[model samples]
Target: MSAGTAFLGSAGVLLIVTLIKLWALRKNPNDPILRAVCGTLFIGALLFVTAAPPHLAKINNWFGTPNIAAPIVYCILTAFDAVNIVLLIHWRGNDDAARTRRQTRLCLTAYVAVMAAIVLLFTMGDAPVERLRDLDTYYANTPFIREMIVLYLAAHTVAAVTMTVLCWRWSRQVPGSLRLGLLTIAAGSSSAFLYDLLKYTAIVARWSGANLDWLSTHAAFSLAGVSALLVAAGFLIPPLGQGASSRWGMFQQFQRLKPLWLEIQSEIPRTCPKPMSWWRSMDLRLMQRERDIHDAVLRLGPYFDASTGKRVYAEALAEHAERRRARGEADASVIAGAVIAKATARPAVSPEDRWMLTSTEDPEDLVRMSDALARSPRVQAIRRWAALVGSRG
Candidate 1:
């Protein structure tokens, strides 16, 4: 995608996520740390929107000043950085509640002062033409404008560097999803630092009578755009990505267990006396299927023969060992399949009296066992066991 498109897309995604988070926050309005985090994300989204090309001009016109969106964008970005610092402090949790609040207040107060300085400096500059996408480079040498650029850059540099250090240290301490998210955010912060340094250097070059406008106008802005996208992804991955991964896993388990559930369910109709309507979620369906399978196992308990289970398990293990598939994973499936096959053949004693010893909390073992039932050897062995049981009866 073009750079503008990428920026808009990233900003749009952040806005959508921020709105969702805000809606959730309505349920727990008293959560201070969570509110700070959402505030950081929300301000970052607005910064991106104001920095976008089309919105930049509209914002400038609304403010009735040429390139006026520049100060507004910087102010929002300053707010974003301040809130991010607050979030980091809260996440670190090394400071007491009062100390954390003091540190947050200090950071916010400093950024707000910087934001005011930026607006006052911009207003003092004499530029009348709008330079939406190139405001910094366009005013690189102007008196008040040059100082304004340096002021915003200095504030951004400090924030970015602080975040990089904090996030890197915290990443080493955290594990799993939190660690991953922190590292990603650190990378984004590092990118922001680079963008600020480049822009500052370019402005300084103009003061030294060197025309390095390309660095500030093109390269640094490009880096800033990339940093924005990365920061959005970093913020989103831990919560949204993990949730999506969980849902996807549940759907997969639901699909995988279906064949086995349907097979056993055919023989024990009362196990699932009623079917759920199609409109229900797959996650709910998976839960229902698991419950039905458990009920069916109980109904088939009288048919279960312990000796048959032992024999089938031993034979399957030996056969799979020869095929080099009887290691860690295959071993469990062999045992579960044999037990389930034996249960499918024995005569019913009392349906209400028996229960499977397997854990209902984890369905992985049950899924494996169901998968093994469809194997040709296991199916044939179950038939033989049923015939033997019939003859004995």
Candidate 2:
């Protein structure tokens, strides 16, 4: 691909990521990692746009100077390198906040010095002709221009190397999407380092009176877009994957509790939530359902009979059920018996019965009991017996 096409594609992807991070930033304004990531992506995008041949030429015409946009792009690129380093530092975590801040300040100072040198060299040198695509090779022998090109390239190389080493090591210590993301970043950063290595080779070839301009102009340019896209995906994966995982977990819990909730909801209408809006978040619906279930359990707790619950539990064990499953069946029969007794119980609830039900009020336990309520033949027999007892009353 042409340099313009590669650069433009990288810019577009970075811009989209930038907008997403910016929206996330509004919600978490004080998160250092988010802030640093946003800065890195935005600056990287800006660097690409400014370095595009057409945009660079327009910038030169606007300033009435030949190749003036080169220094401008170089400075922005240096800033991008600085922010990337800062982001990696932040990502390393705040185990020692003071040390992290010190490291970040030092990195910023060094990169800012590099940017100043790029500007100074541009002012001192003369590039009378515009060569947007081949500036590094064309100015390889020029005094100040050579130093300027070398400075930015050196700065970029250092950032890429540091990113690769740090991410590879960090990836091993982490698990799940974070691990995958860091490994991807390591790969992308190494590609960036290789791109610069080729650029260096091309410049040195020019110094030796040999032509290897394609190394800098073509090979490295192709790698640049792939590098940018990979790096963006690396940063994006963890958060997006974690968000998806959380939503799926909530959905599963909602489905698990749904049937049991519906079974009791009609009888205790006052404990139920009103018809919810279609647009409510899944978590909110889950919270509402959980609240209703807990409330219903407490309200129904008064009717529990300890003797009957113990007898049902003993019978379940005698039937050769696993202890865990037997416990669920016992709880299911107790709840079934309670449903019938709720209408007929006249005396105040004894503390023993309330505590018995309270001990089994765990949400996970409720889910198991609900499952048994729906599927257990043992619980179905108990339910029929309870119905007969209710009729006699």
Candidate 3:
């Protein structure tokens, strides 16, 4: 029913969600950014729950005094925040060599110092109140305690704002998906900063003789927990979703292209004009290049559909074959007067045409050549090869 109890309940829910996200990230540590973000959130939520009223109450009941968990929780939360700061700095340095590791380390150290100062301020004041049970009486009598609360809230507000700004600036240089994730985290952290600001404003107003009630204070705490939850969710979801889609799409594309590659290999040999040995080297090279192209296509498979990729790949094969055939024809003309051509050329081979010079025995090689020629609209339209060499010839 009290403000602190409501915050504890929200913290408990957030703790569970953070744990679930952390488990997922543990299974997939390939994404370093996601892993770091989730790990920080998990630790942060745990620290918050440890410091919240219900858990603090259990600790207090055991020792009959104020629990040290509050300061200890603050320390753990500060450590995680420092870790996040260092992680971002490292990420920035990945793209910009100018960002030295020492600089990042110093930045993290500075953050820790500031957090320590804030915790010290909180500790020196009122014995960290757990719930709003005696808040009205406590505030009326302990004016200095209320001022310390305001100062503590103010310090956190400043730190949160500074962190949000740094994150926003750093996120700009990241890639698309990661940029979104970083910005989401920044936005969530900013919401927490805003909640801190509002809480401090409420404290200041109360000190100034305003009548802000328990409901308003609890509402601010609830919003802060929600903001932290949002940050955790942002860190966990986007990368996992994109990774799943990318893997599935790639698998489907490879499945489709496997058959098409086999078909092309089977068909090339049956349609070429030369003896299989004459063009064997060229044919094998073409097949090898096609295989390379297929592998590259597989690498890019996640980005495009299989049919489109196949069509593109087939076009490349046809072009390579055409170039090889042109080169072969030129070579044949040069060797037209050679004894080998005279001995091997069919009687039907004309002096002006040299298709027999390109004849091959490998049926598979000829079939592949035929498939390439058949697929080429330019070759089909010209009918140049057909006119130059008959099937019987």
Candidate 4:
């Protein structure tokens, strides 16, 4: 097969892989910006494959030109990239304050102004028909076409450089997995810009009456295909890799906590000089708190699906209820207090909590109890139990 065909096939395979991975990891409620970025990259890859390969065909067929489809697809891809950059800035600013929002808007406006300038420079002296025909011709012999190609290359070079710098600066604040992915994306985009430069140089050479067969139309098409695949892969790999890493981290964390939990359970009998019933009650309360904290941490990652969160929460609630049933009121209040402490210590509630309490089941009673304790008028009441349970933290 031809180089262009091979590149396109590879790109298509990678695109499928990227999409599947994204689908699996896109359930992260905290990652709306990431989801949008991945979706745009996927769409951009599709457009690149659809519109970029046609310039290679020697035959003048319907598919060969790609017609208006090429420019439209390019515009869409460009818009997505621009928006992705703006979103990155907003995200880096932590989505806070009116000033940050204004900064994001201003950055986006500047990007648009630059794009408009590039377009104007590229189309300055050319008639629409002539420009369109020139675009269709794989190897044009016109000075204006060469200049336009150079201008396009320069614009892309600037964009790639800016992205590289931005990604570098942003990497320090992000997690390792995300940092790796962003750096990969910057590198891939830089490669694509270099490919554009090569193509522009070839066009310039041809305009100067030089026959550089190595920089063929097919070569440029293949380069584009490779670049698109790399870009898509760069954008897609991070979320999937991060999710996997988080799951492994959770498992390790659980293993580390296991011994501590066992020790806490074993120590209760020795520490409590009261009756067996009292020791059992305290043990149950500690277990309930441990379970809540564990569930909350597990739900923090992207691995858990929508149902997983609810399932975990329900299971914890059931375990608490079972303890209550077995030990009666002696353990019930202590267990409830422990649950409140653990839940409040969590960074944020998962989406599952919102759905479970509001839509799925009647969790309002338990929620109200927790809220009441949190906002109690008497700090001494909780403090009394706090000393009894030795739950200072």
Quantify all predictions' global Cα lDDT against the true fold.
0.72, 0.82, 0.51, 0.49
- Please state the error at residue 313 of candidate 3 in Å: 12
lDDT of 4: 0.49
lDDT tens string, model 4, 6-71?
646765775676576476555764564665565556655555454544432322245343233334
TM-score of each: 0.73, 0.88, 0.55, 0.51
Candidate 3 or 4, higher lDDT?
A: 3
- The TM-score obtained by model 3 is 0.55
Best by lDDT: 2
Write out the backbone clash pairs for model 2: none
Which segments of model 3 are wrong by more than 4 Å?
Answer: 1-35, 67-73, 94-100, 118-123, 126-152, 167-175, 261-393
State the local distance difference test value for candidate 3. 0.51
CA RMSD (A), model 3: 12.3
lDDT of 2 by residue, 137-214 (tens): 999999999999999999999989999999999998999888988988888899999999999999999999999999
What is the Cα-based lDDT of residue 261 in candidate 1?
A: 72
Index of the highest-TM-score prediction? 2
Candidate 2 regions with alpha-carbon error over 4 angstroms: 1-10, 268-272, 275-279, 312-330, 340-355, 359-363, 374-381, 391-393
Clash totals, every prediction:
1, 0, 24, 0
**Count of clashing pairs, candidate 2:** 0
